[model samples]
Target chain A: MPSDGITAVKQLFTRLVYSLGRETATRELKWMKQALIASHSPTLAAMLQRRLSGEPLQYILGTTPFGPLDLLTRPPTLIPRPETEDWTLRLADMLTPTPVRPLTVLDLCTGTGCIPLLLCHLWPPGSTRAYGVDISQHAIRLAADNAARCNIPSFQPAPYSQNVFIPVLGDLRDPDVFKRLLPPFDIITANPPYIPKREYDKLPVSVKNYEDPAALLGDPPDSEEQDGLTFYRLISKILRQKGMLRDGSIVALEVGRAQADAVEGILQQSAGLRNTQVWKDPWNVKRVVLARA
Target chain B: MSSPEDIARARQLKELEPLHEAWSNWTHARQSLEETLPLMQDPDPTMRTLASEEFTSLTHTLSTHISTTFPSLLVPPSSTRDLHALLELKAGVGGSEAALFLLDLLRVYVRYAGSVGWRTSIIQSSETESGGMRDAILEIKGEGAYDALRWESGVHRVQRVPATESSGRTHTSTVAVIVLPLSEDAESMSGNDELFKMEDVKVEVMRARGAGGQHVNKTESAVRLTHTPTGITVSMQDERSQHQNKRRAFQVLRARLMDVKLSQDIANRRATRRNLVRTADRSEKIRTYNYAQDRVTDHRIGLSLMNLTSFLEGDGVQDFLDALRRNWQEEVMEDVVGESE
Candidate 1:
């Protein structure tokens, strides 16, 4: 209730309002205040200065909660979106409650290794083998760090079972990237770059400034045009080249708006993936495309 | 065979016949009792003894009729018998002490739900810096959960010295509880168009996304929905999953809207009858938990029980609940008798 306290809160509110709307700014201020109070160290000015400089709150706070796992997020590697968390949980729940066999998952474009880490944590009463591949070494490192920090207890339901999460630096575009992975995986998931280049240029500063452009843009490195369906094409191409997925295994992809049908077609035509289903986010956006090989 | 309408009419007649029979029998018994009363005034010792014995038996039969038969025939079966309850507890009046007591009251309901084999989940909660509860929402699921905890919706006062207090003086802080039926009426409301329309609701997430998919990095997952006309806004940021939060918010909002409509309907229907049923009113102080006396008292039924520890632990609260339910039924029976007279 002090004058300076009022001004400080108002200043923090003003800084957040430009990037996150007025409503969100107020809410975030509340969150920050609570977080500070909870930590028992009320350094409002330091947090305010960091926010005033346009740094994302996740990085400022040093952690973001992804379901049960507290994932560590940093710059350039995409912070895990709530939409992604929503779809991943739904897909994990689709598998039968108890599985006799150990599960193997490969998450492509795995920034901060959130997808594979969560899958590993939530895997059925058996050991898990997960591979998180990203083009950025920083991302791969962060992903590895998250896997270590998550503290998922390894389980053995079979003779040769051990929980192993490997973060590999590899590009999804290259066919050789499949060689780096022990495939015939029970599950393969990707949240590849799906925003077209033209739209990426026009994105909000909060997104365009902090996150890596490669993670946002879906066009090929050498291509001028962009339709945001570049990764969907690459995913299908790699699956065809390697044929490395187990027969009738699951493959799930997070797609852009109105891209489910096209991605469904691309996956179905070549990858021999069937039983295609489009999953919607809370906002009723067709957010995830699921199929079985 | 009778047609469906004919069958319904037959059932109605079957139900009405019992009431008519009960009415006539009740009148006949009263007349016989009255005749016996006049005989008791006569000087004959045998006649007086027989009349007194008849009066005792008649009184016993009429007591059962008042307590059991009339109430069952009068009040309809409760609509909320099967509903899971959503209990909201918020601190009121006093500052930090009230919030702490609110948390204590939350635990009481939660323990009560658990002891009765009901599952309870905290959908949302907030705490003060000193570990006091600001507000909380608990979803209690089980058969007859609402029936058991229906009368719990009101302001509950706790007279206890604050844990942080050095003065050792009893503080009369209050915690308000509002219990709503968590019914699937909300889920079916989307298509029914009876309760509300999806079009009237505007949703705003904390971090808004311009376009879909891997384009943006969004961590702020708080979602707020405002029913524009009524201005009933439900914002959920907890549960760590936007999907779950959204579902919970909608369920809470829809249940609240349904409750408002249901209360109005009940009020209008009961306009002609003398007030028998007590509506859920949070402004009314329904109960008191006095720590000094080690007692819990439900003000509505004037029933009090010692051992506040076990009461808050859910053991002693059952007696108060049963009494409240019985008192309500008796009120209904009295109303029916009054109407017939």
Candidate 2:
């Protein structure tokens, strides 16, 4: 009923609707209102105005729901998507129902510890252990905060420990990353940066501007051979060389729309992974590749 | 002929009989603790040490019995306690802001479900032009889903300035959350050919709206089902094929019908204890989210928490839930105690 406020609200809402669609815009506006109220800072309102001008809401809110965990979002880590949530929950359900032995899960390139936190939460506590490794210190720190906030037990190295969730900082590209890990893991999940540089550039301004490029484009594709497949190759090689994957263990990775075949190939050729399967997300797009080792 | 109240009291006493035996065990443990207490101060050093150890162990056992085993006996388990939940969120007052708040409420439940390992899915949703959900139905399936989410019914009001506001004045918006327990038998009933007669359902197909590229306008993929007798309608458009949409729509319809049947049963059971506590009412404003002060107050329980952001983010909502469950149990215990008197 306040005409000026209504007009302003409509304008801000319109911009958000344009960029994020109506649902997301509405959510972002609510978050902005909350952020404004929490900080009592006019700058927070200004940030919402910026969001209306095409800023990602996750960056503005500084947190996003990742599966069951509320993960802190900074510029350094990639935002967890709905696809990741679907696969992680699916994998958790797959593993938890008939776990014959004490299971161990290793999440590679764990952005905000979503996968591991969810895995630990779903799996029977004292029987299943999970470790999340990410190269970014900021991501690791955020993941640790999520683990503590979600009340998942932290990793304790004692034999057959009850603690289930652990976040470690290390590069997946490095062979030495496997050294500190307690492996022969029953399951490994990764949602590494799989977008090629060209595809990344074409992303919506909200993503291109706010999200880290390193979290989107792993390394510049050096030829037709190297496009977004570097992380998969590195992970498979490390697992194979270190003998880190237990027999009959699964390595599940979230892949881009058309990247599932390439990812499956990489895992099969390098890791000697067998029985590869591609899973479609809710959107019916090929999103995850699951391979047994 | 006995009144319903008399029957309920009889039932309560019958349930309490086993618990009363467990209660006697607690009395015995307390007696053991009292007997051991005097020996802790014995004159002989060896005797004193032995007595102290026995006293400590007996006290620990008594404390555990009192804390864990004793309080659990008070609340009688209801048939609906372990059922799955279907949570529907509808935008109430304050227009689009209410729709936005509905989305927030949905996220809170979804995230909370995820944290507890419950599986949740949006069975039906109608989004406003501005991206806010007009109404959404979420099915949360897992052990104790209904038990955890039943208190989440009723209206949730949010107080804060609208993001679209130029002159920054706080506004209040309400979103109604209706949580219905999904019967485990509903899954079997869905498969039963006679549960919902095909002749009773009016099926309609339409072109799906919003973001399927060329497929959105070209194909009549969305399916709507209206049960002619009950006037219950469900629409599903998210899936690609019309067949899939029809299946989903029918599934939701069956669940809704099941909910109605279950609610009637609940109403009957609840009629006996109507004076003990207010039944779940959707029109009631159960909770308030005051963002300006970073506070959330559950009006039903009279519990106020200062961490509104965390609560909305699905972190601190558990506090309110825990308190509500505890309070509900306490009320049940009081009702039982009153009936005994």
Candidate 3:
């Protein structure tokens, strides 16, 4: 028999499972079934069709899992690259394995508040307060909305439905912005816009068109300096001056592939920075830079 | 005949298609509702209620889209002067030798403004004692004058040889410009009869100096008008007489106040866009003119102009302005459209 919407969805999901590994396939299908019941609309067929047409399943579903948390990812806020999520969980493990003291954390250029919210959820109660700052208001709203959606399941009672994620609006480039934010924390994390203009032009179509130009390119108009490193310089200065981080507080930055050397160079030249270390992503590309001040 | 579980499975399958339809058709349904709004202005109670609800929902979506897409194009007014609404412009910077570079920048803008039939008057200028201006504020009066010049704010560094330095060394210097509309609400067609309240302004008179000739030190011809509430200070020392200086200072102040008000209105219409985005982060180096490379690069848009000699020397500047204007207008329109969605 020719397939019905449910049969087509089933086949499409089977293909999705086959594309992913077996364990993941099983888990995702289980969720997909739940989503089908929850959505209770024929749009699930359209969602399947869109996914089959090469639209990201995340885009169709409108939410994805980040550690134990569910996040809404949309255009400009960057669909939380699984790799970034992996780095987040890794950072969480290193910082909060056995909470010794209350942890103050800052997530800079926090587009969708994904990292900070997860950090809050993973850390021990009252031991961590997370801050997410983004220059884009829509991104902040998306992040705030995601925070709400992720903390409580759709059906949860009203009183318990808060993600408790604090989202601030301001540019990272502004020195005064840090002063208005909550007091400094034990760790500062950011995955800033690092691609040089030329390199940004060559980004895959998925990124070049959908994301904001500021997020894609490091420097825009008159910057003589490599624009990607400007945020790092600003962050390093803010950390040193604000006392947000204790002396020897940790800084973990996710960097572009070839940016390790230049970033390191800036960190070394910068005052009050020390113990700079680089870590590789699962792909073995030098991805994260962990530093202490 | 199907078992109850099989029947439930088929029912689940049937439910999948509508969910898919609902999600995919959301934007389209929203758009159609927007398009049909103007046609349904019925006077009947039930029809009016139905229409009002639909119109409200459509307008909400449009405004939300606008807030999301063009978040920083407008700025709110926290003060009377609306200082945040002023247009930003930058002159190219070079070094000590860059005095000539700044002079060249001044000439380029004055000429470009002239080309558009705009009346340009230098309201206040501080010269480098050696030569050229340390900083200068020029008031251009024309149709769309402030709107045209607002994008130029940022540090301009010029690189070239100075006429005073015999060693033929190139120096870099900087000049910043602020353009404001004559009245916050008035465009080019608006009459210039409207005057700002003098009570809010502090006017001071002093001697005029710089390139204006020998009468520079003798007379109290220079005028400084400070809008106390907004802290927007304007001075006109370039004119020859006190009356002329006062008029120029007031004109500049009016333009600035108007620009601020206009921006405030735009921001009010798109508050989320302005509040979330740093529209007037003028201190951020927006563009740089490199004498070595003969290039002018904008860091915000990543656009670089190779014809530096022509651009800085008061020669072929319209192309750059046109490009910037196109980008800014596009951004503004995007915000408007987004708000309407």
Interface RMSD of each: 3.3, 10.6, 31.8
lDDT of 2 by residue, B6-93 (tens): 9999978976786888878878878887887788788899988988888888788778777756766767777676688889899999
lDDT of 2 by residue, A1-293 (tens): 23336667677677767866664455456556666667564554466587765565667767665554566667656777655766787787676533346787888888788888877776765777788988788888888888888777665763453547788888776777766776678888888877777666667666667666667774555545447777787777776875687678888988877788988888888888878999986556788999887
RMSD, one per candidate, in order: 11.0, 16.3, 33.5
Q: Hey, what RMSD does candidate 1 come out at?
A: 11.0
Task: Kindly list the per-residue Cα lDDT of model 3 for residues B189-280, writing each as its tens digit.
Answer: 12234445657777664432221110011122345778887899876655333444555666667767766776767578566654232365
Q: True interface contacts reproduced by each model, as a fraction?
A: 0.43, 0.00, 0.00
Candidate 1 vs candidate 3, TM-score winner: 1
TM-score of each: 0.59, 0.54, 0.40
lDDT of each: 0.77, 0.74, 0.62
lDDT of 1 by residue, A1-293 (tens): 24337677667667778866765565566667666766755466667677767777777666777876788878978888878887887876777423456777888899888888887777754457778888999898898788779864322232333366788888776777777566778888999988887777888665788888878888866775568888888888877765577677888899888888989998888766767888987657899889887
lDDT, residue B15, candidate 3:
47
CAPRI-style grade of the A/B interface in model 3: incorrect
How close is chain B to the truth by TM-score, in each candidate? 0.76, 0.76, 0.59
Clashes of 1: 1
Q: Ranking under lDDT, best-scoring first?
A: 1, 2, 3
Count of steric clashes across candidates, in order:
1, 4, 57
Please rank every candidate by TM-score, starting with the best. 1, 2, 3
